[model samples]
Structures are given as structure tokens and as C-alpha cells.
Target: MDLQQLRYVVAVAETRNFTRAAERCLVVQSSLSHRIANLERELGVKLFARSSRRVELTSAGEAFLVGARECLTAADRAVADAAAATGVVRGTLAVGVIVTTAAVDVPEVLQRYRARHPDVRVLLRAGGSDELAAAVRRGDLDIAFLGLPEGARPPGVETLALDRDEHVLVVPTGHRLAGAARVTLLDIADETFVDFVAGTPARAQSDQAFAAAGLARDVAYEAGVAELITRLVARDLGVALLPSAFVRPLAAGDPELALVPVADGPRRVEYLAWGRFNPSPATRAMLDVLGVRGADPED
Candidate 1:
């Protein structure tokens, strides 16, 4: 019925706990519960299935949440529009970033944008490429840095390609293929690998490349960071395929690590993306300050 009730519903749906949702909305649990109960009574349908173990949304709640989130996004955009009308870039800018060098210089872009438009408020969130992309699509983030499939465009969004990273094979100094000039997935198919955690961009790319070559790799250990992956390689745990930039600094610092290029390697392209419609004022300022082409030029 009201924005407060809608917000309570959304928070509860997202957190799946009334207490945490209330805390996030800066309200007491009882008040939030009462508001949601009133909303359900007015609508004459049960929204959440309550239990000792968990909170589950009912069919009605699931259907309502879709429209509820859109309502909230529209309300927030209205506020952002009002702020922009003052001809000064002000109000919140929610930005999400993924981990990698191939992505645009997030820190640099924020720094310059803030220097130019001190009135703008910036909020930063970090996560994997897929998670950030989902947040952007849900209107939870104003813009995000993401590592997408090479040349793949996200639906209903405008993307700016920043840079690309090439995958390379890393080995230990005393390893048999350490001195090899270049190799392919087939060349290293027999060797055990120290790999990225399953479902990560690097791991997915590695798996896809090997699958294309009709090779099955043996993963001896799995790590999530470049540092750990290189540390395992230094111990001769296994060889791995990582972004060239990730392997570069670590290989330079550790004499035990050898970097060999992957011929015809899989590459990941990094992008800065935003919704095609109704981007906030602060988001626009950031695009301009970074010289990034956004969804609209006349805004």
C-alpha cells in the first residue's frame, strides 16, 4: 500500500529473516512485522510461509516481489531525477566491481569523478563478475565492472569494453615444461593442474577451453586467488592456466614460477555496464569523468 510496507516486504524477501530485514531497514522487528502483516491482511493473502528453520515466500509473495522491486527502483530514480534538476551532480551512486586487472580502473575513475563532483555520494560493492552482473540487472547497482564471455553483450544494458585478459599456463621452475615457449590445452592435458575454484570466470574459461580440445584435466588443488595459485605452483603442486597479468607479477617475484603463454588461448573481456534507461545523475557524471560512453549522451 505504502512505500514503507513495500520496502519491508522487499527487505524481508531478500534477507529471508524478519530480524535482519528490520535491522537493514533501520527499524525494529516488531514494527516491520506489524507493517508486513497489515499489508498481507489488506491484500487478503499470505506472503511468507513462516517456520522455525526458515522463511519461505509463498506464490503470492513471489509474484508481488517482482512488482515491489520495480516500484522501489522507480521511486529511487524519481529522487535521483529531482537531485539532477538542480544542475549539480549529487546523491548516491551505487557501483559494483569484480576482481581483475582487465576491468577498468575503478579507483582511478572514482577518484577523478569525486574530485570533479564533490557533491556526489559513492557506494562501492565487490563481488564476482556474475554476481555483480545480476545486481545490475536487478537495479540493485547503478553500474558494475564485469568479466563477460568474450564479445557477449548483456541483455537490456549498455556495455563499454575496457580491456581483455589472455589465459597462460604457469609452471614450477624445475618442471619438465617450464621452459616451453608456448602450449595449448592439448599440450598440458596430461599434467595435473592447480586450478581456480569451480564456477569462477578463470575456472570456467579453463574448463571450456579444455572441453573444446576434448581433453579432461586433473585438478590437484583449487584456489581462488592468484597469489595462492602461484604459491601452490611454486611448491610444484600442479600447473595452472591464469590470466597473463595475474601470472606476470607473481612470476617476477618468485623465481620458482615459470610463465608460458597459451597459444590460441581463451580470453575474457571486461566491461563497465549499466541499465539502458533512467541512470542517475551521479552515474552519468562518472561516465563523463571516465570518458566512458554510457546509454545516453544528452543526459
Candidate 2:
């Protein structure tokens, strides 16, 4: 009738003695006998033949015993599975990242996370900031690495500032300004700029930085990939202002391209974003692994 009743039946069948079954069940003999009687009555079948000396199973009892044992076994397995799911911390974690961000930091972070939580499966998706934001909003991604555009926060998402990286100007070795110790926005105002596509967070940041410095960047070309933009700079097509990390990998590739730090500059703040409604334990664990301390929930 119920799991306990099924367990009691199986215990009785195994022991073949009411007193011994009750002892094994850690229940009083009379109470155990009463529960068995109730189960037999509900089923309208005698489950056991009892005597003063011994107890034996009826034909119906033998048939019912097998089914009862199976039910108890299945119930135990279900409980074990539920506990494993809730407590073992093993599941697929879907993470989104901007292509530039992934190129810079994600590989190292993923390696560390895998080392720490080997049982947890990691799935990574790369896209632009807007696409990553949309994926988090749609619940397709558990968390994402995003640069807030123009300091505008995404609605219904929480963020933790990871690190601020200063933008550096990339110029070809033959270019005159490449020899400068530090280039200012005004210093490179005359040169054409290769930048990220319009509407991207990096572009917006570049525009704001130039605007704040009261200078206009001559737009020569636009490309989304950081590597491509660096290549363009290497070719002397135009100079570009990009995150320092993005330019680090390009340093060894092109001896002509110089990644110079921008003096008197605005640094880009990178944040980890996640849905505020209901964050998964795995997501929280990932933030912890990334050393991201979330904002106060009360705030």
C-alpha cells in the first residue's frame, strides 16, 4: 500500500518469523504484527501462515513478496538519486562569453574550474556581449562575461566586477607614434582607427573615451574579432585602442605592431553577469571559482 508497508512485507518475508522481523525492523513485535495484519487486510489476502512455533508464506504471500521487495528497492534507489542530484554538485554548467573576453581570460579560468570541479560538466558559448546577454536572459546560459556598454547595466541581471583593464593603442612599428613611451587620446587623434563594429560595448567604450578627451577618432575600419583588428593595425591600416589582454597574444605574432599603453585613459571594467531571478548552485560555485564576489542581495 505504501513504501513502509512494502518494506514491512519484505522484512517479514525475509525473516519468516514475526518476532525476528520486528527486531530487525527495530519495532515492537506486536506493532509490526499489527502493521502486517493491516496490509494483508487491505489487500484481502493472507500473506503468512502463522503457528505458535513457526511462520510460513502463503502462495499469495510469495507472489506479493517479490513485488514488495522490488518496490522497496526502487524506492531506495529513487531517494539515493535525489540526494545525488541535490548534494553531489555534478551537472552541466552553461557559460557564455564575449569572443574578446574568451580570447584573453576564459581558457585559464576554465582550466582552473575543471581542476576544482571535475565532476561538473562545462559547456561554453562564445558570442558578442549583446548575444551573451540575450542568452542569459533566455535562461540558455547560466552566466556570462560581459562588458557593460556605456556603463549601462542589463535589466534583470546581476553583475560582479572582475577586473578593470586599461585600453592600449596598437600601432605598426614603422608608424611614427610607436616610439612614444605612452600615447594619449589627443596624441593619436589624427590617425585613423581600426575598431570593433558599431554598437559593440568595446566600440562604445572607445567612443566615450575619445569623447571625454574632446577628440574624434578617424574611423578607418571596423572588425569584431580582436585578432583581426590587431592584424589590421600590424598592416599599418590604422591604429586601434583595445584591452591590454587582447593585445598581449598579438605581441609575438607581429614584430611591427606595438601595443602601447594609453596615458590619461578610461579603463574598461569587465563584469560577470547572471540572471537575478534564480541562480543555480553551479553558477554560484563558478563565480566563487572565478573569485567573483557578488553584490549584496539586500542592495
Off by over 4 Å in 2: 1-86, 102-104, 293-299
Candidate 2 accuracy as TM-score: 0.65
lDDT of each residue in 23-78, candidate 2, tens digit only: 88899999888888998999999999999987889999999987887776456445
Per-residue lDDT of model 1, residues 146-219, tens digit only: 77656555565677777778888889999988899888788889998998788876577788778877889899
lDDT of 2 at 142: 87
Worst 10 residues of 2 by lDDT: 75-84
Model 1 lDDT on a 0 to 1 scale: 0.81
Error of 2 at 229 (Å): 0.5
Q: Candidate 1 — worst ten consecutive residues by lDDT sum?
A: 290-299
Relative to the true structure, candidate 1 reaches a TM of 0.78
